[model samples]
Target: MGGAFVAAALLARLGGRIGLPTIPLFILAGILLGPNTPGFVLVADPHDLEMLSALGLVLLLFYLGLEFHMDDLKQGGRRMALAGGTYLLLNVGAGLAFGFLTGWGTREALVLAGVLGISSSAIVTKILVDLGRVGSPETKPILGIIVVEDVFLAVYLAILQPLLSGTNGPGDAALKAAKALAFLLLLAAAARYGTKIIGRLFDTRDNELLVISFLGAAVLVAGVSEWFGVADAIGAFMVGLMLGSTTSAKRIMTLVHPLRDAFGAIFFFAFGLSIDPGDLPSVAGPVAIAVALTIVMNVLAGLATAKMYDFGRGPAGRVATTLLARGEFALILATMAASAGLNPRLSPFIAGYVLVLAVLGPLAAGRSDWLARVRPGEPQPELVGAGK
Candidate 1:
């Protein structure tokens, strides 16, 4: 922990001068101090660390929800739907094609495609925040699309879990889908009404009470999701979204930011520690393939979303560029896949791929403005017309 803190501080202090994101530094520190390197050996019990990481992830999602509003989603829903739908289709199609060409079985191919189709919202959101672009017009649509995509990915995983686990047949898959849909509907209704009641129940001036209430709600929803055999991350995220629409969302976020940051650091550090350096080279080929596909798919999805919203080339390109980074969700998916017995060989590959992208994704997003400015054409209306 001390080493991690020192490294994080050094990176934060010097990262800007060196053109590196602070996150990559933290990751690199983890690799160096992890079992992979000789710097230090800190291996906490996996179950305990994962529980801590899970808490970090929950808080991260909660903050994401605070940034969201029903009106924003409603306004951008069409474009988000278009971008998310097309992106998933392309990713799954391409992943399936790759699997078939590689001689994988149908079920295995489907699982691979499903895993690849989803991008990491947690990573993308964090990158945007780091770059201070979260409030930018270009950022809004990208985030909106991610919000929609997250919902879809959650639903997809819910269905895929049973099938992959051999715990359910096709009929059961249908039932699971129905249950997932019902859960979404119930969540939406709760967001529309439940948040208001909760807000009234916990006065904003009572910060401790508000925080406790917010966390309690998050845990309750997460428990509900687990009870229904869905991923807890989905439940946490949905609860956040619902709470985000409330008047108290901002306060909730402010109260939780410090706790979120501390635990979130632990979460990412744990992710780094979990990686085995010995296996990295062996998995490099697959990781490379996965990273390349992530970049391509994210860009394409961004462009498609931009075009759907009638955004010009610059904004579209910027949005697409910004969406390139992968983080928490990717890890979550990989972890889930490993547990589900997808392929032992694939786990490290996916982890390595996520780590690579987590670093590169932000670099790409950070440079998006420079890229946009140098593009040959009329500047984007959103960029040029702003403050006019």
Candidate 2:
């Protein structure tokens, strides 16, 4: 594991020098080193690596939530909600249509919709950082879309877990959905209202105390989320949101950066670790089909979202390309589907789609400006440099 991290760090540095994103490089390394690649740096116990990968996911989301600012939310206001809602309907609809056309059953189609709809928040957030786009005007709405996406994801899982367990009927599924929705509402309320106590807890400049407090809070919240059957990444994100409401958000962000980088790499690598190379070629056709459809829909989603919100072409392109990748959540859906025996072929299809998109997604986002300008007779907009 230690060697894995060291190798990941070296790969990341090399990728950086070549203007490549680390998200794909990390996963590519995992593929090269995973158990599937016998005689390589094989992960002997993938189950154990998965547990740590879960941790990596939690911390990665926590750090992302920390990057969001209240000002952005407040400033973007209603446009964020409108854009996010529209984006969801469009993308999810595209997924469902694709699934049905491919002859999947209703439930399987819905699962496929989920696999295609959600963007890789961890990878996308990392792209924002690597491209120095965090504080940009376009980012506010993108983050808003992510917030909405997470909420929908929780609801999807609420219904999915029971669906996999074989719910008695639609009413039973509705009840579970209600419970999940209630939990999400309560979690939001707590984060929104419980700022004073949290603010005072680590208001002092004691590095040791602050570190312990933040880490412990993340763990406690994530553990509680697991207890409630919610995704731990969502739980950690909420914790980060609560912390973001406080004055110490900046301090926490600075402190958490190093940890996020290290663990985040592991998270991406572990994602690749779970893939079975033998299963991929068989599913390549479906993977390519899904990827092609998603790319078109994602671009449309971004364009429509930006136009509706009155954003410029530059921002619209950013939204479209940034969303081209699907990641951890999609894998979770695939894993659950495989375990429930829904379809023997779903997992490989998803893994291949996600793996390909992770690489293409970042590259697309990094060059969004150029992609947007590919339109005839349209002059490309100038990119504002970082910190400008």
Candidate 3:
């Protein structure tokens, strides 16, 4: 654990000197020193850091929830939903098409659709903070899209699990879907109407007690959410959302920074540790095609979002690049596919695809201005007439 932190920090510092983002650097550190690599293995088993990594994800989303107020949702509710729906339709739909085109089994294709569809919430949240764009106009839609994806994930998992298991009937899948929807609605209602009750729960003056109270609630709620077939990240996020309305939101935010950064680093590093560089070579061709597809689709989605929100090219570029990385969810799907014995090639394809984008996403987002300048546009009326 100590070695993981030191290595990530050192690599991130080196990358910072060159204006590179810390996210990929942290993952790179883990890959270099992990068991898969032929070098000094800091932790032989990736599972050793699983608990810490999970905490990192929870806190990251929790912080995101705190920062996202209920008013933002109220203001952009319909637009946000439409934008998010558009993004999913383009990316996930493309993924399904690509999956079928691969001649892989139907189950493998379903896994690929999810792998190609969703963005990494952890990486996206981290990029917003690192780039100092947390409060930027573009971030709201980006976050809203993630919220929509989270809910979609719950439904998708319910559908996918039954198919993969091959034992459960449609009734079972429907039951899971209902439970997931119920849990989400329950949390949404709490965020809407139970702010006072939640606020009082964390109203203690002592910092220690306050921390324990909020942390316990987040983790407990997150665990229960998993039982209800929802992603724990959303659970933690909803906890943050509910508490965000309370007077203590600022206090919780201030206290969670170090925890989020520390655990978040661990999450990325652990992700890298699970990848075997050896597995990437065979899937290089497919991975390249998938990466290209994801980039193109994200740009279109970004433009669509910008048009909906009446934003300029710069904001469009931010939306496209910030949501480029694919991490935890892809990995989870890969793991599930492997367990279900779907296809031998699916895991390697996902690994290579994720590794490429994990590095590229942050780099592109940091330089999103390039996309704006390079994009073709009609000449300005003033410049055209004056030059003429």
lDDT tens readout by residue for model 2, 214-277: 9888878887775555666767877887888799999999998888878778877876776677
Judged by TM-score relative to the true structure, which candidate is superior, 1 or 3?
Answer: 3
Candidate with top lDDT is: 3
Ranking by TM-score: 2, 3, 1
Ten-residue stretch with the least lDDT total in model 2: 379-388
Candidate 1: tens digits of C-alpha lDDT, residues 87-201: 7787767777765654545556666675566656666766677667667666767777676766666677676655655546778777766776677678767877787675676
Q: How big is the positional error of residue 1 in model 3, measured in Å on the Cα after superposition?
A: 1.1
> Clash pairs of candidate 2?
none
**For residue 87, what is the lDDT in candidate 1?**
74
Runs in model 2 lying further than 4 Å from the true structure: 69-73, 100-108, 126-140, 158-172, 309-315, 332-344, 369-388
Model 1 Cα shift for residue 326 (angstroms): 1.1
lDDT: worst 10-residue window of model 1:
379-388
Error of 2 at 344 (Å): 4.1
1-388, model 3: which lDDT tens digit per residue?
9999999999999988976667667777888898999968899998999889888878877887787776764676899989989999999999999999999988888989999999988788878888888888789899999877876775676557546654477788678767777888899899989999889889988999999999999999989987777667778988998999999999999998788889988987887787777877888988999999999999999999988998777888889999999887787687567657887788668877877898799888887876665456743222211101
